[model samples]
Target chain A: MEQTLRRRQPGETVFGYALLLLGLFVMAEGYRIDGLYSPSSAGVFPALAGLVMTVSALAIIRRIHRMRPAHIPEGSGTAREFVRRTTPADVAVMAALMLAYMLALEPVGFLGASFAFLFLSIFYLHRGGLLTALLVSTGSLAAIWVVFRVLFTVVLPSGWLFR
Target chain B: MSDSLSYFLMAWTDPQLLLLTAAGTFAGIYIGAIPGLSVTMAASILISFTFSWDVNPALALIAGVFMGGVYGGSRSAILLNIPGAPAAIATALDGFPLAKRGEAGVAIGLTTVCSFLGGFVGIAALAIAAPAISEFALLFAPRDYLLLAVMGLLLVGSLSGESLAKGLYAGALGVALGMVGMDPMTAEGRFTFGTVQLLGGIPYVAAMIGFFGVSEALAQLHNLKAPRIKQDVSRILPSWSLLRRYLPLSLRSSAIGVVIGALPGTGGDIAALMAYDQAKRTVKNPSRPFGEGAYEGVVAPESANNAAVGGAYIPMLTLGIPGDAVTAVIIGALFIHGLKPGPMLMIETPHLFWFTVGNLTLANIFMLVFGLSGIRFFAKVVETPPGILIPLILILSVVGTYAIQNSVVDVYWMLGFGLFGYFLRIYGFQVGPVVLGMILGPLMDTSYRRAMISAGDDPVAFAQEFVTSPLSLVLALAVALLVISQTPLWRGIRARLAGG
Candidate 1:
């Protein structure tokens, strides 16, 4: 059995819809403030921007459909295919870890939160070296704390734990 | 004349001042080479530390940092594909590709020398033609400024990666984002959605770091184990023949830099992009095609941005208006020193003007010395393992974003844009236009509205003003040419003309 090489681009449909929704929302927001009747009104520029965005998004959708038949296979699990193609598992994990770091930041303090985040990230990426991760994370956080707090006099968040 | 001569040579004679200037320039180059650390940030930080010192020493250090930082931004741009500051955005376009091909050292060396040459041109203008240039800058009307902003946005056509439509959408999106916050004209909220923090709008600095720094970090996670490129450090200094060849282009870009930098609300970023665009249109046979490691691409932006340092001072010393953020900080320093910066400044404190020119001259010389010597070391720095470098970049992005206003919310915005920008990059959209839009969007909006209001709500009157005013008409014609140059018809005509 011979398999043909198929050229496919990812996320056009998703991107187009996202942009369309954003354009409509922005347009509605513009109207809610000031009606678009007056060109010099506060809403005029934003409304025009929304209109351009919406039109461009429609064009993107049209372009995607025009190009899709030759590339993306028409079959089951298409959404899964897009997910796999667009967001590989490694990237998703890193992104999730970043979000987690942000959330834990204020509560855990700069040093506390940053150290943990750094260590976990480095260790995971380095494939689990306990001592190196421990040393690397601590040293990096210390350098930052000294530079920002002691030298520059910036008051970084102490968080509940450290202060 | 002799008093002015004494002022010009003062820094060279004073040991403390010369030492401070040299130290400041050296630190600035390193700080500027680091991702997420900008010249503006360093200048602002120095203001606090140097507050108690005498004004002359403070000014010398800040001036050195200013010159060094502007040139330093290109180091990271060439080596890492991450712009150290907004002004270096254009530098990274072709600089990164050159680095990937192991030509990073030559790129760095060429940009450094061009930057020095450009700096000299800017200083020459600052010294000789400052008064006349400032008077000319004052002649620009609101409509003219609007045309300039539009002209900048027009470059999105060239910078847009694969699709013009995608670029337009991104640019419009950026414009809309910039429109958020209270309308400066009235107290009316435009896109605030009742948020108090957003009353000031999204910080473009944070947006810059996220799009270029954090987003690039996220993108790097895909090939975390990919082999790093080894930069060639053998030919670090550019040859005299290469310098001789591009001398005309360098001088033209420096002039453009000075003019744009002297304009209020414009800065090195705009000048760099404009110069890069000009090079693209004019250089019929480039060493390489642009966005693919063209030497002209690196030279045009690096030279323009550094020259902008001197150009920025032109307005501050003459008109009391700041040319850029760093210059604005300098204005504050001047105020602290009990000197007012304006037209009166040139006459009343001629010594200050001459002193600044001399100081910048010394800084530019130091910039050349420091910029050329560290190429091999800089190349080795960029070869850090991705596993180490990527996380380091993300941390620096967060820290830099937070440092802007000490606002955690800004960090969140950086992360948000980082994720969004990562997706955009994956989809073949260049992140440059988005940042370009964010930077230029507010300028465009405010200028357009002001120009409209000046016309008393008369659309025809407002439109006519573009053709009626000589300066506006010139800008209008430039904008028209920019549009025509982007069209297929113009390309076809040019091709046919060349064939004939």
Candidate 2:
């Protein structure tokens, strides 16, 4: 079934239509703008660009429709495969980790937040391994900190906790 | 020459400068070796830290990162087929193949030497040719610049996968996307959708991070199984015979690197690819076609990309126009330090120029040392499970984005683009053109419009002026040929002509 799609023409057709719609939308926006050569006008380039886009879209549609059929599929199923392969669980975990890091950034400061972020990330990467994650996290943070703050004399963000 | 020698002597004698060079090289290498961490990011991050420091040390640090980072990207390209930066894209073509054949040590060693040689060539070019190049660069009117940009856009045909039409579409789309944000000629927003934050336009760095870094991470997550690479602990030196054989090719590639690097917006990545393509076209009795472990393939790109660093600085120092994004940020750093880069920069700040030249040379030497010593450690990274690496990459992306301006909005933008990039990649859209578009778009737009206005809105007059100017004519022809060659009809005609 996947192989069949690779030989089919639907993908290009879909892409062509998408481009057409986008071009139309841009053209509408371009028309709504003021004069082309005016100092504060926005229409000139957009109108030109929209016309080009629309022509290209029409060309693509014609080209795809006229092409000879091959033995292979038209679509690679790459999009579907990618969506299927990316587990919701993995995304959720990563999102949760990022959220935690953002929340912790100001309160924990650069060092603490970075340290925690590094640890959790490393831990997640290492699959919740405590000792290995701790070692890697501590080493990475210490190195970054010493290099940026001490050697380079960089003023990293310090929170109230550190003060 | 005497003055340059004296400057070199000063650099040699300054232990503090030497230490800074070493540190910068180290940082650049580490940051560059990581898949998502670009040299631009490393340099930008260093800016806030170096904002208060003296100009010389700050320059020394940034130069080290620039040199080291350019060289560092090859590590992953060789070991994992995943280029650490855009500059390393060509390196992966042959570098990974060599690694697969258990010649990783030799490949790395060859690249290291080539990188150093490339750097030396670039610095030499910068030192000798900057004034002359700057004079030439000034001749590039808006029409010429527009043509040059079109030529760059044409490269999408070569870079895009398989389909020429699809590539052009993507390239056009990229250019259209670039037209977003506030128009340069007029203060009105073109595609900002009436947003205040977007009034300043989409940040190129953030877009790059999203397109390359985050999208790559998302892709890597799909393939969690780490391949067991055979570690061949061999002598980490290319044979003298091998070096002699490839010396001419390396020199040619380095020359290409320097020239492309000098061109604004086109940097190490394009140089590397062009060099690789040239080498493949010319080399006889190759071990294999590229992407099959050819040593020359690795050498050409590695040398060229490293050399491009020197090429990029010429315009930056001579005209105050950055050759690439990294240099743009460096220009900001220079301005912050009360140093303006322009025609009289050499006369006003000759010492600073000399110091930079010296620093670049030293950075190349340091790249050789760090590159060889850290291979074992970096190879270990490729061995890590993708599941682990992917999450860590995300964290780095988030932190790096936020750290840029300390703005949450940037992070949100990054994530939005990241998801968009991931989808695009899945649907077979190439990101390189997008990046190229983002970087070159505004320049093309501003320059063309300004040129038009300067030409009194007379299209015929603009054409006449453009054709009459030798430089503009050359660039115009090149752009025309480049665009035409990519069209299917032109390609078919060319093929038919060859057959005839």
Candidate 3:
């Protein structure tokens, strides 16, 4: 059967170009490590991988160029549509919350950080009210604590603040 | 022989092991049936939780999970038309149609029985074939190992994602990531840039959790509002006549599953697809038109994918090469337990082999019991909105990452990779090759270095050895053929041949 070409996703071209740059940087790093001293040099395999990456990235760009652009809905700019389609408000908020949770894991500890992140994110995503989110998050946190900390004996961070 | 039998029955006879196996299988079913939650993600996370336990218990739980997870994917596929895992993508084709026709119960029952049968075939193959393969694998040289790794990566890249280039890019990127930290051979930092943390290399478990777990959760955001479809299921147990009728097709699909699953880098997803395709072509008269709702359609994929569970283990146990993504993660678990997977693994720890075989057999039994009994509960479970599930998964990802060595740095790595992996997914790139590449990268590097050193660092001599030795020649040819087949020239030639 003939393969169908899917409409190119928004930001695909830019992503391809970014990957290409990464490949080039890696290639340069590979060269910096060892200047093609020998086939068995520490840098050789990495260099080969970088070269493959570079070549593939260029191929990806070429393929992307052949595809038609995505159809933006009426009354929406392409850039705005791209962001909305790829990373909607909920996703963006969740991502930001994830970043906060990770940063707070040490200072705020697993329990505090996780509870807050879970409750807030669930409340935001679920939109079913705050009390339910609080109950769910708390129950979940307790279950996780019991499972990992108590039963499995994993040493979760106690937080310097708590100490 | 008697000792092997004893080991094979170990899980069945032991109470703790039996309970763990049953529990793992039960959990695995739910995991596999839930959309956005995958066997690979669950297995990777489970490894961290189980890391400190005895190797036997750890293996038992993981084995159950592996067996159950493969079969469980069909549950959601049948009920919701959303494949719980990639392996059940084909199952959803006819499974959902059957559900729509109010034969959801019958469909699930047939799928459960066939999956059980296929699981048996796979285990039987593993029991019979792995030791023999391990013996042969013992004769492999470093060059041959390199060729095998290359072949695996090439197959994974070409078979998955939108384009070969994208696959290759993801794979090479993984190889590059694997090269980070200290050079295993010389203890010199390769990509550290003088950073003390970089010297330890990126923790692979972190990478696995991020790429598979976090990235998947982020991707699920796209379909957060997709309405859940409800189906009433009744009478899940298939009649004996129904079983006898589909037995031949299930067996045939199971055979296909074993061969495809045993191939390194490929897994149940591909096996199920091929089996479904094969069934479409071969089965002369179906209960219905191939797509409209055929019993064979559901039977082929479910059976094949479950059978693939056994097929996937053969390479990981015998050659230290993963048959697919889950096995790749399992390899990490094996390493953590101080067990080396390869030919020596079989020779040194023969009991582990038999115990696994037995455990998988037991898991299959549990899969059958759980799969048939819990249709109503499973329907409700699949309806659990991604809104709640995603947060839970994120929390699990964090805990799973932290559990591995309790390193905050690894958690950061997980987050970073997760975000990057999400973008990669959006761009139509598969993250499977990236993880597979990471696992195989160091193996390829060390193998290449060893092969080169043996040839006195002469590129020509190293190249010459590929063809001079019989084993290496076969592997070299296989690799070359794999690469060539992905090229435009090969496609053009094949098209010409087909047209004429």
Candidate 4:
């Protein structure tokens, strides 16, 4: 069936190899636990799952290899390029900002850190100017604070700075 | 019959209790609509406040929220393509397409009525056949449950889109990921890497938000400047004719929902997915193809999830076992209120059962009212520029992740999964199976091991037991059929047989 189909895409092969690596890692790690030698052992399931993954991924690689073109197309880096192109700069920035917010959450406090992050993120995404971002951020954070703290009784991070 | 009718009206009799149910249902709709804010999170939080309250009112509020939450999930799924809850994952498959085609209003309207009808069927099943269903549910052995989970994984065959191999790989990866936390049976960590935070396991909700919400948000960035589709909110409620047309399908899906939901360790998510698959195969003339904005797709999951609510209550109320995550939390509330949740509690406190049924029924009614009326506003949500909405969604995802256990670790996990999911989506790997693996992974693992242990760790004995027990044999056959039916060989043979 695979032979009849077109060759796997550039990214597809990379993903297969990545899965192969992950399966190997999982299998290696499964043995670290005690009592995995037996079928009922703690490590058996993970190891078995890992083995299945390893085999499946190997199948993918073999299929890709068999289906590879004779010329062996020069620049096999298109997959990397696709990944790079797909995650545009704005998304990369937004993702980075989110990571920053999470890191700052406990230290800067929920309200303060959230307000700053929300304002910056909104402004960055909208590019609709900083003023609109400020109002929206403040209002949205206040609503969140009220909903979690007042309505649901979930305590937002108070922050070491606040305390 | 007279006694049952009176029990049904119990919640309506008391103004305070009725108000609580109504308010909880009203609040649940909005909470469930938010992409990252899950109903389980909301219900669990509600318990902190409701623990001290009387049992009657507390259960009433929770019941209302549970029913409303299930229906509310589809709201965001249809409008935004990001399912608010796991149960709505299948809903988004067809629903978002409908929204793109400017039928968001009709989609929401049709689903709301279907969900209400599904809720009714579930409640009716609960009311009329509680004991029998609960007993039947108890017949499931660990091996049987494992087969059921396998049956669930078969959904990837339908959900996989164009590549069965990709789906298998993705689903297998999800199962592997689910195995990361501490092994429940042996108290040994599998993939924690000597980290304390990893011991508790990656939070499934965080992964869900990452997979569906953040991934989609990133994908949407590609078309940021595309004109937002205008939703047609002209018809906010289903026409009588439309309802009549879908009534049979809704009822059938609801029955599927109740059975799956009644089983311990399974709930609305599996029920919804299975129902969607069933509709895909059974419905000969869907208004559209199953995945590309089919009304039948929306109807199957929406109805099934709602019906699963009543089904979930069956095990929790009758057998003392929580049917799903929300019910499990509600069980904690019941214990906190100094009431036991097992069979003795039911025998001793029968009123509790009837009152919950009443509460759920009322909440279903409120769900229909709020769900239908709120379409115009939710439809408008899609009209917001992607620039603003995407950022808002991310922020909400952050807050929602953080709210679960108040741990920044979960937020980080959400982000990681979100990035991974984005890559997967671009490469044509559906992210849904991964979440399914995460959700069902632990259950599958524990059941398989327990069944193995029960068989004295002998594979032959385990296989023998499956064949010996009628129930197990039936489920094993279903699993085998599910596996065989997905093969190209099977498809070829089927095609040839039909041709001949």
Q: Per-candidate interface C-alpha RMSD?
A: 4.1, 4.9, 2.2, 2.0
lDDT of 3 by residue, B194-252 (tens): 99989888987688678867887888788888775455566778999989999999999
Q: Which one wins on DockQ?
A: 3
For residue B353, give model 4's deviation from the true position in Å: 1.4
> Each predicted complex: what DockQ?
0.43, 0.25, 0.57, 0.55
**Model 3 stretches with alpha carbons more than 4 Å out:** A1-10, A70-78, B1-115, B125-131, B231-360, B375-379, B494-498
Cα RMSD of predicted structure 3: 5.6
Q: What is the DockQ of the complex in model 3?
A: 0.57
Per-residue error (Å), model 1, residue B334: 1.3
Give the per-residue lDDT digits (tens) of candidate 4, residues B413-494.
8999999998888766788888888787788888888999999999899889999999999989987877777778888887
Q: Using Cα atoms with residue i matched to residue i, what is each candidate's TM-score against the true structure?
A: 0.95, 0.83, 0.78, 0.95
Instruction: Return the candidate ranking by DockQ, descending.
Output: 3, 4, 1, 2
Q: Indicate the worst ten consecutive residues by lDDT in candidate 4 chain A.
A: A67-76
Going through the candidates in the order shown, the clash numbers are: 0, 11, 0, 0
Cα displacement (Å) at residue A57, model 3: 0.9
lDDT of 1 at B247: 88
Better of 2 and 4 by lDDT: 4
- The alpha-carbon lDDT assigned to residue B373 of candidate 3 equals 93
What are the per-residue Cα lDDT tens digits for candidate 1 across A1-163?
A: 1123223366666777898899888778877777755556787777877887788778666666666342445573667767776687767877888888888878897777788788888887766488888887788788777766786677777798655
lDDT of 4 at B287: 97
Candidate 4 Cα outliers beyond 4 Å, as residue runs = A1-10, A59-80, A161-163, B1-4
| Residue-by-residue lDDT tens digits, candidate 2, A3-92 | 112332334457568878987777677766665654224575566556666776786666657665433335646455333444344554
